[model samples]
Target: MLQHLIDQDEGLRMVPTDRNELTTAVGQLNEELRGLPEEADPARTRVLTRWIGIGQMCLGNHDEARTVLRQSLDLAAALGNTRAVVATGLNLGDAHRYAGDVQGADALYRSALNTARSHHPELVDFALQHTGKNLMERGDLASAKAHLQEALRLRITKGDAGLVESTQAALARVELLIGRADASAADGAVPRQWSGEWTSWLQSRTTAQTPARWAEDFPALRDAVRGLNAHQRVYPRHLRDQPFPAELIAAMAAEAEKAVAADGYLHNGKWNAPVGDAASRFAGQVDLAAVVARSTGLEVEQPHTAVYIAYLEEGQFLDFHVDEFGFGEANLILCLQHERPTAAPSVSTTVFITADGCLECDLAAGDCVVFDGALTPHGRTPLTAGESITLISLGFRARDQASRTVTNLPPVPR
Candidate 1:
């Protein structure tokens, strides 16, 4: 409940901004804590403690949060509790991160990850996801990739939807930085000729929606899409591997290469523009419909929402984490891969939005992919060498999410 309150008010808009209000809120939680059964449930107590910590943290009571989180972890240890350990670690690590103690935060997270391996692997996945995020911020690319990759693997294996979306977000950033297609959109409308029917017709023949043989009629697109599916296939460890159709893989690789080679795609540097890119379709009008439809495959059920974009470059990557609580209804990322040579990798990942497909398909020379921003926990993977135009758009799904999220914005706008 306190976390929900925090989600609703980062600036303490709901709670009085005075120290008195902070004191009262903590005091109320304390009263409940004193009554919490000593042996009834250490796990529950730990959970409650984490919440108390969060309420304190956002209310600018960092010291209080640390104390609460520490107590929470200690109680869990007494109960031989792994969940409490993970929860308390996360809470403490978050406090450390917020307090500018990155190293300390990282240590706590690493410890949590170790504990997770034995006691709570699921929680470990989350720990790695968070640690991966911290590494990204520290510019520790290789470690970031490993941690994020592990998190992605664990999330997918367990079908943990929340972490999956978050992992996808992180992977996209990694691709933008290293495997960037680096394609700059030609100064033209999203190609008046493109349509989802064309894409669907093309995509259906390749994945679960359709079969690969449909291309017998249009061999070029057929070959391209077919080849794409094959090339990107993660060959199974067992024998009789599903031969990632060589042609299919090559075709997508060619497309990724072409996309990256396009001008306007950054080659190997940084560029800055106004954080607000005028909506090409409507002035003072945000087409969140387009974003939602494209990213999530879900139609907008409401009106009166706005959308906007934020761009990043080679050295740019966001922390691995959930989108801020109440920033927008959903977040959409349209990546313009920086144009590059033919042998490079194009970035993509599976997503976890209950709305649409579970993955962000590989973007081609000119593909605009979207995913549920707020519902999906996401971040970026560090890049080795490349640039990208990541079009980040947000629409308000619920007023509270929009308001609660966005404590930190990508550096470009600031």
Candidate 2:
């Protein structure tokens, strides 16, 4: 009778829509276990306890779930049941995560992953997925991406469409958090060939009194000196408009808000912001590269560079710099939210350096700008005090050069 109840509970867990039924079933199972003999099968007892904990978690009883899961884990370990141990450990980790104990959750996940890797290879993907999620919540996006990528490979080989989709969704979230894995070269370092030239230009600009003086002295460094009025040539076309659907814009805004509320931003010295989760998922649903191609008249390849949303706060400023060769050939920026003190006189602007002079673009919510970020130098002016802005940045490679490796080329300054 106990074994029959255990089997029924397991089947109920597989169909989560019957939550009330499952909860009632778990209660009956617990009552049956209490009436069982002390000499009941230890393995069955371990599985029963783990399932009950999982049911508790489903009902949002994290504290109760953790306590029961620990008991099940101890029993599994004592019985030398590796599979049960791993499964129970993962559930315990989820309980910790649900209770906001990220550190505790990560420790349990790592233990489960290590044990699965050593004993139960077939179950490794499950451990990997949980560990990846725990790391993502801790803001270790690169590490999270690595784990999810491995889990994805394993899931694909297992040929489970549902499992594959779950891992893919987790990976997409990580990608949104930390742009593309290859968006920039390793460590954002400048290439050897351009380092000396970049250093020289920096020194000259530092000492030069005015833009004209720098332009006159370094005529050979025309490409390096930004915002210099040295030429009267026409620059590349830069279009600004509202092109995204209203619903999509609203979804992206909601994602940004949720990310901020959850403290999901990665605090690198460059910028601390959470890229929009909806934006990444939307990319999968739509052919964004083709949209870029139609708008810019450039043949764009699929799988464009990372799609990310950047949140800029007061006193934050982006220095003028050209993008890397392929990834930034065509760049898109969409303004999601912008707020400033009404009394403040200065307006923050996205500035592009062109042959004519500085072209300043003031964007509001729903506004977007498309430009050649790879060849042109661009940046944002410092936000005035009490000001903030949220912008989603998308990158694409021109079809002609999409196949080229980014490492082989020089790095673009940030």
Candidate 3:
């Protein structure tokens, strides 16, 4: 009857139902366990404990889940139940993952993988799936993709529709991000010149923001980035040189003019700008999108919002503000034209407020800047009378944090 109940619970586990049913089930199982002799059936006890742990996890009681799952795993190991050990180990890993202990979860998953590979080939996919998910959350996209791809390949041969579909879906997500990261290199958009100073700066900045748990993996990641084709290598966050070829820039400028003429400028209490049809099209291009993603060191999705051409006229200025989330994490601004009356030392500078201090960037025609605009406070100095500037603004969202809404974030105070 207890085994029967366990089977029933497994079948109903994923069904959307009242939590009270699960709570009652847990209580009944515990009561039954207490009635059994200490040695009556260790196997049954292990199974019961494992199910209870799973139930606790479902209830969001991760601490309780971990304790019980650990006990179950020990019992399974003692009984030489390789299958049970692999299964329970995965559950324990899941408990850790849910509790935000990714490192702990990864260790358990790796152990499960080894055990399953040696004795339970059928269970290998489960181990791979969990490990892949854990690594992806930890920002190790390359490893995650490889694991998921392998799992998907195995699942397809198993001929289980549900399992195959689940793995496929996970693989698809990993591929999307991998494709984004690989786009720039594949498109031959890597900058012609890369400075050692810039590489050092990028390495420091990337390392500083990376989670401490990922410290050990940084060297591997750095080497992998370096190993990529010139077109495949990720670019530095801030580049004084243009990513696009001179010919491409000229063509893009022409398109910008046409787009502005068609869409006209719209004032949104921020600046006068026209819908950047040309910029949007170019941004959506695989090469440009890849460059944007690589430059930010983030796997990004195609821009959902339209790009814009900010047509700043004399006396026009932009207030310091961070771009909205989802649509503005990484901002790329291309200066199509900057005309100063009499060319009197141009004061049309772009300013970014950083922890270090204020960074004043003076952009000339054809120059561009790419930065984390979603979190960084930035703005433009007012244009002097008879001064004018044209800029194409493009934004991309980190794939992991993609959202359709353009959150109206408040401006940062100077």
lDDT of 2 by residue, 1-414 (tens): 222222212211223346677678779869876877999998878877888887777666766788889999999999988898898899899878766555568789989999999999999999999888888877688898899999999999999998898888888778876764345445344442353444344443432213334335444344444432221112344455646676777787777666556655543212434443366555655676766676777776654444334545666666555555444567877777778789998767777655554567888877767777654556677787888777777776666654333354334333
TM for candidate 3 is 0.44
Q: After superposing candidate 3, which stretches have Cα over 4 Å from the reference?
A: 1-17, 176-414
What range of 10 consecutive residues in model 2 has the weakest lDDT sum? 5-14
Candidate 3, 313-339: lDDT as tens digits: 665666454444434556777777777
TM-score, predicted candidate 1 vs. hidden true structure: 0.38
How many backbone clashes can be found in candidate 2? 0
- Model with the higher lDDT, candidate 1 or 2: 2
**Candidate rank order under lDDT:** 2, 3, 1
Cα displacement (angstroms), candidate 3, residue 274, comes to 44
- Return the top candidate by lDDT: 2
Runs of candidate 2 exceeding 4 Å displacement: 1-238, 260-270, 274-276, 307-312, 402-414
The local lDDT score (0 to 100) that residue 104 gets in candidate 1 is: 67
